[model samples]
Target: MSSRPWTILGVSTFAQTAASASMSGAPFLIPALHHQGLTVAQASLLVAAPVAGVMLTLVAWGWFADHVGERVALMAGLSLTVLADVGAAFAHSHLLLGICWLIAGASAAAVPSASGRVVVGWFPPHRRGLAMGIRQMAQPAGLAVASATLPAVAAAYDLRTALLIPAAFAAAALVAVAIWVVDPPRGERTAHVATNPYRGDLFLTRVHVVSVLLVIPQFVVWTFSLVWLVDGRGWAPAAAGLAVSIANLLGAFGRIAAGQLSDAVASRMRPIRWIAYAAAATMTILGLIAGGPIWVAVAVMFIASVLTVADNGLAFTAVAERAGPWWSGRALGVQNTSQFLASAIVAPLGGLAITHLGFGWTFGLAAIPALAAIALVPVRDERPLS
Candidate 1:
């Protein structure tokens, strides 16, 4: 492949990293907000607000990408996210803050929906798993950034000021997308395309269902990691933040590794199936040792975080390849929408579980979806158009 595709991947990664910063940063703010005045339920709702927003518009953004192309879609989405982040920074009340984050979430949906299309369009089938893996790294990369910086920023200045960090990330991504990203050439489309991906095969449906199931444990860990570290482990918030940051950093590498593993094995579903099972096992172990020694808990959480995220690149590649170039955007959008909807539920449900049932039981229960995902993965792995 030409360097052009790599260039596009670089730009998309930056934009995705920026888009993830704001949404991922929200969970880090929960402790600060709870300290200020909000109840655990209210803070959990705030943590979930962006994902809820993403759920509302993921398909729309995907459709927009299909119609207008990746560059335009990403630019518009990032621009809107920048505006929303700025508004969120100045928000005076929790309601106003939630509203702004919701808008930002909806806008940020464009990054994943469109960027996946960009990769599938530019890279050949043989190279796509690695490319998608690199592209998928954007979220964890952004989350790592947020985990490393947001807690300290919120601690030193205040939660409101901390909001500016992601706003800056959004603005940076906006500029990058405007200057660098280009839609792939039109010839990438397959000859006999479906009018909509949903109409043709059960492949896309299976991928979507598995993705939703897999996301439950991922979100449960992401949503509660910092608080669990601090409250359950009795570590300082900053120290907990550092651990989460490390986990996210490792998770980024895990995504790339999983992608390469798929490419090596020549089967996307193979790697994803293994990842799901690993996620279930690790999460179960983490649940069992929830109040164990600090090193042990951190070790299990780190492993769980890596395994939970490892499936994204593999699953995304499967969807894009199956959907073909024509429907890649919308198919990916649907995939993400399903995952985000699950993620939106996870925050509140996990929060309530943490409050009432304790982290041990919640972590144990979170593993069931991963087990379900393992069962779902045996459905056909071939591209729908092939």
Candidate 2:
């Protein structure tokens, strides 16, 4: 075996991390937005804009990766993300800011499906779990960076200046991807022979639904943790941000561990089901303690954050593997689209829930989706990869 796959994995991880920084990093700005006089729901709407953009364009980018190539898609997408982020930095009004971030997220949508295909294409079945696990680390790693820096910067300087962080990362990633990303070779196919993986079964659909269900709890924790710490528990913004950042780091490690477990068991769906159970239990525990002592709430929130996210890499790998090369890009795109579609809605609704119901009730309600996801995990549909 060659070291090329490892190198490619590094580039893919960086590209996705940059994109994630630009996309998933918006919620970190909610605290800053609050300081600017926006209400909770309004601030959440701004945070949801990028995710809505991501939901809108993921499939098209997947199609592009399948038809053109991963390298072109990566370079083109990252470049546009950099430009959009730059535009967002100078936006004067909330509408303009939302639009610019929407554009950034739309462009950055290229990273997930394309980079995912790159990993699936390069790594063989035996090593794919670990590889995808490392690759999946990008989201939380990006979030960790955002958590540690964005709130602090916005507090110190201005929101506009803090907005530049994602752009800088995307620009750096563009350079790396242009220099290092070579699209993996594809198998030759006859015009009439390519088959659609979705036509014959409900496996991919079930996985997508399960992912959608699971994302609600994940986003509930991720989008609200800092605010919950500050607004609900009376912590300082910087300390809350630090705590959230540490939680994200633990979540990242949790994903890697979940991936390794999948490799060991030779089943992605199994671990996902188990994680769903853990996520349900954690969310319930957090809800029970949401109004309790500050220390207990913070600790439970951290654990909920970690458990809620552990299923992402496993579900992603299963979708790509089952979809095969001919359909993996589109399938993975669907997977991301379903999750982000839920994510886009969760912010505003969750904010409203927290507003009327308080953190305790809202968090208690978040457990419902996680509980639902446990039953839809599609464990029996799994087949061993080569």
Candidate 3:
């Protein structure tokens, strides 16, 4: 109800954006990796490194957040990210760079694992949807930052120099959070406070599964859009990067719109279900038109970016609200772990598929998972936030 929660949300969003830049932003370096003689599939593996690391460590970070506090978790994670980024910036070998990225990803997991809890703890249910929606903007906003800067920097300088961008973001965020972020107050511990939200129902599990399915298309779009534009359409790398950056910026707003819709409808699952349907339809349409006019394909790609990411805040709010305050951190960890697990696989497989099947068919195939997610949304299982 006060400006304080909004301030916390702002800092938390920036922190997560820093982490997202380290995690998802790595893909922007794919062109540089290709010029270094790595194949598309191989370059995608490097892009996958951070996501795989995030998948491995999210639950541990979540547990740390639950036991410690969001501010502590964020500061620790961002600090480690800065260190890992420095290692990545100086690493000469591909293997060493991948390892550094993995470490950065693992460390950056704290932002998402803890930040969602910060929003939920601070905002009431009626406004939590919008607040979390704004919080969810961090991902696409991070991608936008990466898309706009990393490719240009990599093309102008060396890959090592470009790698410092995320490190700078993390360092700046570390300072902001250290100065501004305050952990939301908690109620006194009771038996109910410690109870596991996953015990009695399949709700959390279903949400996780749906989220994983949705992540395939989301990652596919972000990971491949730049390459698709440059290599497939014969656009300049800088031009492609600019387009991707604009798309991601628009996608960030889509998250806010989805969040506001959830608040209006008072149901997180419903909007997610609709988003799944929209994603499936968009992917199918994009595939069908992939060989069509360039303008049309780009337009559809932009739309796909918006629809694919719209459900994140809705699902995120659902998970934390369902899990309750005590367990929300770990619950969010599980939620992100599932999505990142799918994301980790999406790159190499997507690259391989793009190589063999072409971007159109591979993108069309992404709709299958989005369609699957629709049925698994668990619309009836949602409960009012405590």
Put down candidate 3 lDDT per residue, 333-365, tens digits, no spaces. Answer: 999999999999999999999989999998899
- Candidate closest to the true structure, highest TM-score: 3
Residue 343 in candidate 1, Cα distance off native in Å: 0.4
Residue pairs in clash, model 3 = none
Q: Over the stretch 85-118, how does candidate 1's per-residue lDDT look in tens digits?
A: 9999999998999999999998898889898898
Cα-based lDDT for every prediction: 0.87, 0.91, 0.93
Indicate the TM-score of model 3.
0.99
Residue pairs whose backbone atoms clash in candidate 2:
none
For model 2, residues 238-262, the per-residue Cα lDDT tens digits are 8988999999988888888998899
Q: How far off is residue 4 in model 1, in Å? A: 0.9
The better-scoring model by TM-score among 1 and 3 is 3
Q: Clashes per prediction?
A: 0, 0, 0
| Pick by lDDT: 2 or 3, better one | 3
Ranking by TM-score: 3, 2, 1
